[model samples]
Target chain A: MGSDWKVILCYSITVLYRLWWIPIRAWRLPLKNGERYFQDIEVPEGWHTSAEGRKWWRRYRATIIVPHALEACGLMAIALWGQWKQLPMLSLVAPVFVGMTLAFIAWWRHANRARIQRPQRVAVSLEERKLRTYFSWSLEAALAMLIAASWAIMAWRGDADIHWRWPLTLTYVVIGLIVMKAQVVKHGWALPANRTAEYQHWDEFRRRYASRVLDRMRFMNIVILAGYAAVHSLAGVAPIGAIRGAAFAAGLGLSVWMMIGIARGETAFLRGSARSLLPPATTIIDWKKGWWSFGAFMAGLALLMFWPER
Target chain B: MYLTVDFEDKRPLYQQVVDGIKELIARGTLREGATLPSVRQVAGDLGVNLNTIATAYRQLQEEGLVAVRHGFGAVVKARRSDFAGQDELRKGLRAALTQLVLAGLAEKEIVTMVREELAVVGGKAK
Candidate 1:
């Protein structure tokens, strides 16, 4: 393809790719803490018989399905129509991502308000939580190395007046995510009253995965930031595009890994119910926010590819 | 260690928490220097009031079974012989034996039951 055609084609592919992942909008039942379990994600078997489930479904369209449908259509419009304005895509979507994350934090606090309490015959050992308990050591090492490399590249590429400001701002965001994760795990967390032994095991398993999802979200964010830094630093070089390629590879690779791990669903939950957890697992990603980093990665890649008009 | 606080439990909520944690410490499920979940966390999990959990933690600290640090939650301290509640624990045990006696068990059955109970509670190791 011609150079301009190639650029336009890649940009279109990105926008179209994102639009395709439009929010899954799977209907859920009105069970308290139901989202944490799979039974709530889909129409429960024989749910047409349950008055509560059916009652909630009655409001499903106006309260959920319609509003969500409109929002998705609106976003689709922006993705398609906004291209002509040539607004830097990150500038377009970054605020939305940030707002969604904030919304999530708020929703999390709201949902986590203790709902049930009952005495059980059994006692469980409280597992001491640490960042490493969920996030792996090698992943930690990789993050450290990536940060070091990003700094190294920026130093090698820029003059004495390097743009330290942008990285600093991004660094603050990364720090915020860390604090958010800590807040999430540290909060007064509880289970539904009278959760059975099997349910408790399942909940704990979900929680561990939830914590890992938080770590993975942090890792994904850092990777995207590092990837951006590396490519931007390589602004003058051409063949070094291979190294630029690495950034996309790393981000994309992690997304795939996250996908596989979540896809191989465990516990008694139905298959594909994990789709409801795409954003950050039990922290609750849902469809739109779940593909958030992938969207961010694509936006960065498309922007960088089109930079310099090279 | 898992703890259940039945609303129907006869003991004070704080005492139940204090006893439950002590049992775990005795069992070595919670090792020295291990941190307990924050007061807010325990309160939320058990659906008890925050002050109730805090009171329990303070009692544990007073007894020297666990050390409470600001913002760091409670940490299991090394099992110390200097426990200020040594007599209190003794009285509690005597009360339990009295219950066994009142239940009209044969002396052998009572002795055997106490031993079995000790083993279950990790008191035998202690």
Candidate 2:
């Protein structure tokens, strides 16, 4: 494969991986809130019955999924336009991938809305709300750093072609940073003071909703880890030109281990029935830890990209 | 109806619900023969378990303010005829005064406070 194509392939693969991992990111946000946000939104009233539900859906789509889809489409368009000047078969893949991507987005939106509309009990406290916001931004920052560093290394080493893709990666990082900063401003840089009345209300909500929230997180993490494993395995097997085999190996191992840790933590929380005991701030801290680990993992991979074993 | 249940209030949700309803009955928000929303309806509206609502309704039934029909819903069975009477008001005021006294308030101070409160309520405090 030509150098240009390697760049295109790398960008495509990274975008696809990130897209698949979205649910994992989404799940982590609520869990990060120390399971408080989960209890809040999962309450027995239909999603349509509350103002918060509508806000959640709108922000989720706008801040996370829409930006991702737009970036994916833009990257794919650039790839196809590049290929159209040369290979027709490559152009064909673009339309199919784009269509399927849009379909998945639509399906996800519909399913989430339906789920929200169900009569579920949610008990949420201010502390939990703060945690949710904090962790979500942290996760985005971590993922964006990983993706950006991966692309940076690829560009620096001349392993991937399109230099223009740098701006898009930067945009993701900037957006993530802005979100995190916004959370800091909103939360006054401290965990909420204990409101016993609200805490009691939220405790009841958590007791009912914790299991479902953990299950959703586990399912999403499993899917993302599996997809990463499959794709990386294929990349290894294929006789692709200039494959950063070691970096890919390290990334896959770390991703799998991270997913396992997430599963283990979720299981422990569920089995111990410890959601009620754990403060909502703890969820944000755990989520922040996850992001730190993710950032370190990506940085490690980027290092590998610099010194490849030929 | 406004409903609040305090989990740490050393009172069960059902008991709290019952107490709230009793207060309503005492205050005459629930009139004699007034139909109450069904247990299922209240449970759905409050986002609580149906059993919680049932327990509250049962407590109200025991108090004779509510009666359950076979196919219909719980209905107010009796009115607290003296709910608004001076004796009942005095008893309520005495209960309030007793609570304050128990909390270390002096009787003379409470009497003076009550007189001033009455003056203010009567719009002659100025």
Best by lDDT: 1
| Residues B39-99 of candidate 1: C-alpha lDDT, one tens digit per residue | 8667654545789989999988887888887765788886652455768889988998899
- In order, the TM-score of chain B in each prediction is 0.86, 0.62
- Per-residue lDDT tens digits for candidate 2, residues B1-126, read 234444456777789778766656555666667676666545543446778878888877876678976444578787543235788788998898988899898888888988875654433212
- Model 2 local distance difference test score: 0.47
| Model 2: per-residue Cα lDDT over A209-302, one tens digit each | 4333333333333333333333333444545432344444444455445445545555554443444443443221223433464355445434
Model 1 C-alpha lDDT per residue in residues A136-217, reported as the tens digit of each score: 6786687778777877877778544445655654555556556555654543233333443444555556666655555665
Best by DockQ: 1
Which pairs clash (backbone N, Cα, C closer than 3 Å) in model 2?
A32-A283, A34-A283, A39-A122, A39-A123, A42-A121, A43-A120, A43-A121, A43-A122, A44-A120, A44-A121
What lDDT would each prediction earn against the true structure?
A: 0.56, 0.47
Rate residue A249 of model 1 by lDDT.
69
lDDT of 2 at A3: 42
